[model samples]
Target: MQVSEFHLTAYSTALFSTWIFIEELGLLFDAGDGLSAGLLQKARKVKYVFVSHADRDHLAGLLQFQQLNGRADGPLIHYPADSGSFPALEAFSQRFDPHIRGEAWRGIRSGDALPIRDRITVDALRNDHITAPVEWAKSLSYRVWHKKWKLRREYLDLPGSEIKDLIAQRGRAAVSEEVATLMVGYSGDTPVEDYGRWDGAKLLIHEATFVRKEDQDRARNNRHSSLEEVLRMAAEIKIDQLVLSHFSSRYSAEEIDTTIRRYGREFRVTCPVYRLLPGQIHRDVLREEPVWSL
Candidate 1:
């Protein structure tokens, strides 16, 4: 769960609420109800927020969040460009909290990249969770990338003096090229459609709202992923850690964990697997003992 130094905290429950706060990046993935209450003063550190879709369970706490921590210089919120609910809510937030201003509310589409830091950027990828066509922008997933440079393989054995001299003559860019590493991938809410969507991610946080194929029928009215489908997909991908959330309250914690253990063994999964149980706030979720450890 620890990708370099980022600490992730979250609360998720299907049809009720869901949100994740990343401490190192000052970023929040969603703004479900009780966000302000759960994070308290720590919520002030959030400088950027990405909302996945227009579902009420995903955005019910925006008003409280804005009122509590919104300022002229912090907490920019982004959402799908075609989600009309956001614009209307933005206008309502402005009028409801007349004293709050300068908080940027932006409309973003797939393929857009927003820099969270000088060397870190968050990229959005469209996902099929809102029943919108591929041309429409109604839902999204996010990936956080860290940009860095390392000595070229050919120059690794070069003398320090020569390397410094080469840098003076040709600049550091001549010897090294920038590379981006996928630190974390957030699959907001979607069906298990692409196994490669989160491949090679150091950590992946995904939603598994149902436990079985039979239960998936109940979720058919809305787009969602089932636990079996998600784990099956994870077994095929290259991820260091997997955190599943947004499970329905219908299943008990024991039921969810038991099912996860069975799947982990059946799929021969080798990475640590974690789950966020219903009606609970998980702090430093990665640090907690995974439901099924490697």
Candidate 2:
């Protein structure tokens, strides 16, 4: 379970669990190895379960997840109504036991908000530029806000019911005064345009698929962001810390470091940045980690 400043805590029990928070509630983002009985045991605390995208890497844990969780009775499973080849609803039904198939699944578009609690709401934004059919590829960027407090936090969710609300209500998603901090933004396999128009994201968990200049066009064609684009987005959004992740297995850590430095020099932003690799660990993960500078 690799945890970083950008992503919420991830638990590697019988199943793989990675999540992000809207308020205090746990929003399960990716549940890998859904068949692992341990996966459900670990996810007992999840209030909202979201399948970020429909790609096999993103949806790999759904079967085990449905097995352990046993349907919509526990946490609400939100996903996109139509995910390229695999319509989210049909996939859920096919993957899970028939008993759990129709559990509380909500379909979402862009610009909609899903209420996690009385005080917290998750708002969704669209990434129109990315054309990948994977759920994470067509990722739904989010803004989590505390209604009473007026504080806003941003994250990324795949197209689901929660996201539909966020897309439906654009511009109205503002943070309240009571919100003390804003955390990082998740780029679940997003493209360059996904980071555009971001105003005040403190941290960015973006993907750096290719490091070499020769591979730049390939990365762009795949709708994955390059190291250069990550830096540019951070500089433009003024993120406090940027954690580049989802690297192709091809690159070594040293190679990634060289690429980051190369792009960092070009962008010249003061934000601290890091890269996330497999098997990394962090303690006391929160779905909604604070983003305010202490």
Candidate 3:
């Protein structure tokens, strides 16, 4: 319903680990190290796991997670179609464990919107984190949408009884149409590129792998975002609330928080900004006080 209601628990560190668990949707975005241990028994609730890329830091926990939670029903996993790592992992996992079902592993590409729950779908959109041919889907960003049928504008003034009668006579489609709301978005391991994808989202979990521009610029092969760049994008875009993750270990928590507060003021961003500190597992991230909101 709202970003805060997602019950998000996450942990992220640049080149080390990154994962986000949204309890309400039973969705885990990127299965990095320690995911199973961090969530414990709650990991069983994961109905969908979306891997962002082939980077080991982003998907190292898949084997252990599959071992612990795999079943016929699913913890259905979707990864970039072009990334060979997922298929390799699936092979080794099935061979080693021999019991974990490999049936639900799926290869996905950009623009694939797979349903995770009734009226809710997760869309995989390609990001520029890993470069390849235009057709290759190596890295991704994801969005969760909640779709529901609402009364058409023409039927908005009708009485409840009349609406029910109309529905019975003409069918629901005659008076109602589906409307979708962008509930949550996860920008998995990416540099700041387009701000429009996350516009009007209820919440966004984005990666900010560096605090300094020089460090960000140095990593030319596999791209990453600087804290300033992300904040700048946030200022330009329309988003309700933001959660920044995947900060480099080089920065102390104090420096990260201070920079956020400073840049937040510089950018004049109004939305509440939450963050996952480099080495900590942020539990109920929305419940904690944000680093900046003005």
| Native-to-model Cα distance after best TM-score fit, residue 276 in candidate 2, in Å | 2.0
On a 0 to 100 scale, what is the lDDT of residue 161 in model 1?
95
lDDT of 3 by residue, 175-282 (tens): 999999889999998888878899888898999888877887787675888999999999998889999999999999999999999999999988999999988998
lDDT of 1 at 58: 94
TM-score of each: 0.96, 0.67, 0.96
**After aligning candidate 3 to the native by TM-score, how far in Å is the CA of 80 from where it should be?**
0.3
Off by over 4 Å in 3: none
In model 1, the worst 10-residue window by lDDT is: 1-10
Instruction: Give the poorly placed runs of model 2, Cα more than 4 Å off.
Output: 1-7, 10-24, 32-41, 71-73, 84-96, 99-102, 129-139, 148-184, 194-196, 278-294
Cα miss at 155, model 1 (Å)?
A: 1.5
TM-score of structure candidate 1: 0.96
On the 0 to 100 scale, the lDDT of residue 287 in model 3 is 93
| Every model: Cα RMSD to truth | 1.5, 10.5, 1.3
Task: Give the alpha carbon lDDT tens digit for every residue of 109-139 in model 2.
Answer: 5666777767656666666434645454355
CA error at residue 103 for candidate 3, angstroms: 4.9
